[model samples]
Target: MHTTTPTVIITGASSGIGLAIAETFLAQGYNVVGNARNAARLEQTLAALNCGERFLAVAGDIAEPNTARQLVTHAVQRFGRIDVLVNNAGVFIAKPFIEYDQGDIAQLIATNLMGTVNASQAVAAQMIKQGSGRIVNVTASIALQPLQRVPSAIPILIKGGLNQLTRALALELAPHNIQVNAVAPGLIDTPMHTPETHEFLCGLQPAGRIGRPQEIADAVLHLSQAGFTSGAILPVDGGMSSGVW
Candidate 1:
């Protein structure tokens, strides 16, 4: 099967790593549907891509269960089918676990963990119908080593759960011929992290630098093309996973 001209759905596609991944797939001549909460930003980003008829921008909160189904529905309606799904919509807040309120905890889980589940479930259904597909999840290095204290307990909880979800779904989906994988990214220069925070994180890495969104996007692209790979966690962390302190 020639999956080269596949249709991809990427959540959190307004900026950062998600945006980069969308752009990468667009560049590869794949039809792409970008989902984000910010309609204005999504429009601007897609307009800049100049993808002509190869792209569609859908505005919705992936954290909501219905929104994931809507996103997949619109993508399939616009294009024909969905071949790749990138669960990239997530948030990170720094705070002590004790300082977190119920709402904060709920939001983190909804956006990071539940959002991934919803999107993956919806997309996986389509993939199974089609007989083959790929899913690439974006996770954080904090999930690997829980020692790094981000001020917030939410990010840790959400990311940790996300990692577990990734592994579980990979196993369940493999039998359906749908490969599921995740990329554990170290600190990257995105709007989520401030300059000071980036510098601090960079110093903690063996590379002495923070990673780029494009770097992570590159890994996503590779995973999408690797047919025989599944249930894999590829870390594009500038060696941050190698213990950088």
Candidate 2:
């Protein structure tokens, strides 16, 4: 059915875990369509990856439905079809539950929850026609098991929603032969966390270390190629979701 190379669309691909995933896919010779708010940064990443023409960077806010549509459209137009969709675009803010305002709640819902929903809808429509596809969503470990050290109820709520969506979509799309899964990371060493904060964040994980971007990327890649695996929520965190140590 597919005459061209398999194509993957990765959101939040400007940096960190998303960027690492993009690079890994590109290295594997898959056509990568990366989306993010910064077109310049996406372009820079594309250049750094050095996978000319195999990579396309689409820049826009994932919170907007239009961006999701554009990403799917671009992937279809450039490549033959969408084989994989990585819903990695998200915003993380940790604070006391009561400290969150209406704006904070709205943003968390828009970017983390709604963004994945919109992108999944667009990609699933295309995948259904093709009769096969894979979706890997990136969520936070706090969504599975809360950490007393980090009181982030608002954002975790959004991530937790994605975890549920992964299972639901996997079943709903199973008949269509589409697979859906999620990867939850804990205290990943990304730009979001400062060097000074690493020491504190590492203590939360039982492994006593923060995860690398490639670690998450590797888990995503594993799920992408795992034919029999779906409705799975893989925790790439360093045993943070197991229990408090």
Candidate 3:
């Protein structure tokens, strides 16, 4: 490990792609701050890594603007600086648009879109003060190509908004030397996916396999270090974006 390790703050680190990315960064010798709504689950997940003093868990609802700011503040207080921000906290609702209640739609937008916005804003301000940082937003492949089987409402709207935000923020933050980019992952074998859904998504990909969480984490790591790469959306979806099937 280097004498000085880069510090990263990952939202939704309790499970799925967020948890995998946190583990990967820790393995690479980075000081990691894992943020999630469930304190017990966050503690359990962090304990499993055996990362010792290199990791911290901040428990709160990131969908709230104030909590998002507090999450960044906690990381800064612990690590002195945040070198990377992974806006990976999101909620997915698969019901048809018409079937969605107003509250359900609001919740989906709050967790998926507003969460990213709030976290990015809070962390980017600190990064600007430090004069450099990286922001990686995780989006879904369904945002690129809408699928009928997968209810086209939430993911399509929320992830598309995220992609747009990625580009806009990249341009705005470029002058500060803060790189902003997004990763679009498809059908990763995470707890979020059911066995039947995973198999169906795998069959749609030309690679004939569902992606692993680590695969998406690798892409996140790449974006984190690729200072020259900004406003780009790299798809780690086993060629699902190419429609190679």
Candidate 4:
């Protein structure tokens, strides 16, 4: 019988939704390995959580395939098996398509696209060997429903691909008993958003308020345990994707 607890690797885990997800999993007794580009910061924050030996911080550039390999290697070495991989690392930039610069485009592709791809590839191999696992992505709801005021085609373009990747990977990995899913969120009240923008952000959602990081964390937790569910993009978007507000 399997005696050890499940292990989860959460990318971009130093802050925002990623941090919340880490906290949630830790609270539930899952061994957590968190990744981020900032090593000191990642260690400082998560280590302070007093998770003892159960929490590990592997700091590296999320955009690199090496980083994803490092995460998988560390998780397997420390925890013995990988059960969940949360591709929660991403960058969202909003501006007119024409206004986007090369740097912006490159960063978006690196953080939002390649990070997920690399992490998924590395983790899937391990999970397939183990015969079971879960992969949950944190994509954006804006990819589905566009906002004229927020002409962020570049971010949507990459995030849109993730939504598709969720389905594609789910189909490809089903026989291995590995489920792939995504949580597409609307405006969330993270450190990414300043306090002054909260009121304005509230109006953008049918719920009349931005979502909390913990809310997204909750959605991810659900996907992590949902064995019968796959290829599903669960929108925790406060009705933004529901219809016209």
Assess each prediction's global lDDT (C-alpha) against the native.
0.85, 0.91, 0.88, 0.93
Q: Which residue runs does candidate 3 get wrong by more than 4 Å?
A: 1-3
Off by over 4 Å in 2: 1-3
lDDT of 3 by residue, 1-245 (tens): 22357999999998989989999999888999899999999999988989987898989898899988887778877778899999999877787878988888888888888889899999999999999999999998888877666776766888998999999999999999999999999878988888878677777777899999999999999999995899999988877777534
Cα-lDDT of candidate 2: 0.91
Preferred candidate (lDDT higher): 2 or 3: 2
lDDT score for candidate 3 against the true structure? 0.88
**Candidate 1 vs 4: which has more lDDT:** 4
- Weakest 10 consecutive residues, lDDT, candidate 4? 1-10
Candidate closer to the true structure by TM-score (higher is better), 1 or 3: 3
Positional deviation of residue 104's Cα in model 3 after best superposition, in angstroms: 2.2
What is the number of backbone collisions in each predicted candidate, taken in the order shown? 5, 0, 0, 0
lDDT (tens digit, per residue) of candidate 4 on 40-117: 889887767889888889999879999999998888888899999999998888998999999999999999999999
- The model with the greater lDDT, 2 or 4, is 4
Candidate 3, residue 169: Cα displacement in angstroms equals 0.6
**Most lDDT-accurate candidate:** 4
Which whole-number lDDT from 0 to 100 does residue 54 have in model 4? 87
